[model samples]
Target: MTCLICGTPYQSTPTWSKLFLNQLDSSTCTRCFEKFEVSESTIDFTDFLGTPYEGAVDSVFCLYTYNEPMKEFLHQYKFLQDVALAKVFAGNLQQAFQTREGIIVPIPMHPEKLELRTFAQVDELLNAAQVSYQQLLVKTKSETQGKKTKMERLETSNLFEAMSNIEATNYILFDDIYTTGATIHHAAKILKDAGAKRVDAITLIKG
Candidate 1:
């Protein structure tokens, strides 16, 4: 098999070992895996975007730093539509987050963007990690955040809305990357307003 990130060929291993490793490997070679800068601290949204709405997201857990390698990985996986590359982070996510009773809600994609991308990148990440989630939120706007300035992005709230009545008191929001903290805060505000008692978030990288 080939390494997903670097395209390096996997060294030959015993049949038994290969079978065992295949079940756990994320298609990332050891060298490439070592290159990733694992996050050693928790992220505070208030530090980036000031205080969030009352009773919004409590905290955010990020897995890695959004360095150049991670940026390239996301560009390939999301923009280039390399679907299979989702597996490269599946094992890492599963290890970072264990299943819990609360709902796992992936950050929603705008309908128009969804039509173009074919799938939500966060949803694909959760699927590859074998994590179950609910599609409770929907993007109300189609404007891409990449085009917006920092001030505009921060001011651009109300981008997401709950699709229906939410009964869950606890929720875990999932996303591929955290940039200005606007997206997660806005999404979590809607969840909290819909009766979520405590909302937390997890992201693959903090940009």
Candidate 2:
């Protein structure tokens, strides 16, 4: 009935699944949504080959690229604290995780940052997708990764600690973005060290 991004009312043609499954509807308008680009497969992690982070993550699946549209979207969703934007990708995200066979675990925000951001963006994405996930790890450090160089990020001390007992099963690490691979690697390494059988990752974007 209405596009979430542009605010101009638009008609969403009915589909079979929309009629039967009570699924989430498109929150983004065709014009705005088309501006966003879906990326290809996993990002380049060849730099980690000989590093301690090698094999820390089995694979990474990214849904979108950090294109201009995505850049704008993230600004509104995270920095501007528009929680509703999380629903824009709900249906797509649900479909992505439908075939994965691991326990979903979203990367957590630090307490202070969570207070500032008002909501956990990563968790909100999963919730908007109606995907169940466990909060197994807690962020112990709050250093901003945006300013750090690739090597600086890789060499930084671990930022997470397990908040609960991690079962020795495969776990899917979910995050909002994959930048230098530091956050995912640190989180995955923590899970691996805590005895998770396998750790793979999925992100909303590949930066």
Candidate 3:
């Protein structure tokens, strides 16, 4: 089989396949898995205006920017309901966090919206990443922020809550898009309030 992340050729055990089987419908070759590897240079978390996070203590990582292959990739995963793509996305993330240890939290979605989608896209991607993480945040049932302006998004849109004590000093926040800084800002805020030393936010795209 091939490595799904880096596209490196190698043999994979059935047990390993079973671990990530739920992430993908079919097993990925060792090479493809290796090629999709997530690295520090690959991780990007810049805002539209090219601004980084405030008091950024640690590095923020993102698999793909909102462009080209990344744009197409995310579009397929988000709108096309391409479940397999979720595995690749998650695998990339898993590789990114292999060395770092901490809680990996996905941006929460409203329960009503979650019901409509029938799944949390961020959660699915993180699951594919194959890293240990927790669903610590829950979106308060609030208005959708898509139609809102940047300030409005920052002002409204309930995105996160502390599910447990923030024991992990190194925390990473994951999301599909980095349109505005609002969503992640809220998540980081919640994590910090829970006693996390640092909160790093990442997104697939920055636009």
Candidate 4:
């Protein structure tokens, strides 16, 4: 098979360990991937209600707009048990951040959610990207952001806390999806309050 991103034919051997197999065939050619670059698109950060705010995340960098194979990949990564897809998704993010040097932080999941899912997809992606990451933000309590409207989500956005021993540094917040900026905004706010010089966000898909 050929890699859509890199056009490389699949190697006979797999890159992942024996127990960690990929659902999608791995055939990305070296050349196709080499041409890809990570970049930040110009996006305005606003609360769910379209209320713009300063000091919300400075920028949001997405690898792809929510579409096609990427969308299916995300669906599998988030809902189904297709954890391997997280690695491919993270590869795009890694390419986007090739020139960046900072602590990569995942947006984080509540303990209950983490316990239910057994993993944070963003965390898995960061690990797959081979990037140095710190779990800087912690969700103190369970608040269902999925059910709320944009403004409602923004209004009750005091959900995260900066973990202890997280040194202030240039950091990027990572997540799987970007719908309204509410979650990223709150996560960035905590990092900024904790003294991160600049807080930028990177997501696999933008909605």
> Top model by lDDT, which number?
2
lDDT of 2 by residue, 1-207 (tens): 678788988878677876776567768778988988998856787878877788889889999999998999999999999999999999878878887889999999999999998999999999999999999999999989888888888888899999999888999999999988889999999989888899989999999
Per-residue lDDT of model 1, residues 1-207, tens digit only: 888888988753445534763434578777877787887776655544454453477888889998888888989999999998888888778755674447889998888888899877889898898888899999998887889886687666689989988985888999998877778888998999888888988999988
C-alpha root-mean-square deviation, each candidate: 3.2, 1.4, 6.2, 6.5
The top-ranked prediction according to TM-score is 2
Candidate ordering by TM-score (highest first): 2, 1, 4, 3
Candidate 4, 23-51: lDDT as tens digits: 33223455543343333455664333344
In angstroms, how far off is 128's CA in candidate 1? 0.6
Pairs clashing in candidate 2?
none
In candidate 3, where is summed lDDT lowest over 10 consecutive residues?
Answer: 48-57
Which portions of model 1 miss their true places by more than 4 Å? 11-23, 47-54, 99-101, 149-151
Kindly provide the TM-score of model 1 when superposed on the true structure, using C-alpha atoms: 0.86
- Model 3, 60: alpha-carbon shift in Å? 2.1
Clashing pairs in 1: none
Give the lDDT of residue 38 in candidate 1.
87
* TM-score comparison, 2 vs 3, better candidate: 2
- Residue 88, candidate 4: C-alpha displacement in angstroms: 1.8
For residues 1-207, what per-residue lDDT tens digits would candidate 3 score against the true structure?
A: 554334566665556644764333224565443433333344333432332224432555655545454555566667777666676655445556665666777888888877777778888877766666788888885676788887566555346667777774878888787655677777787777677887877666565
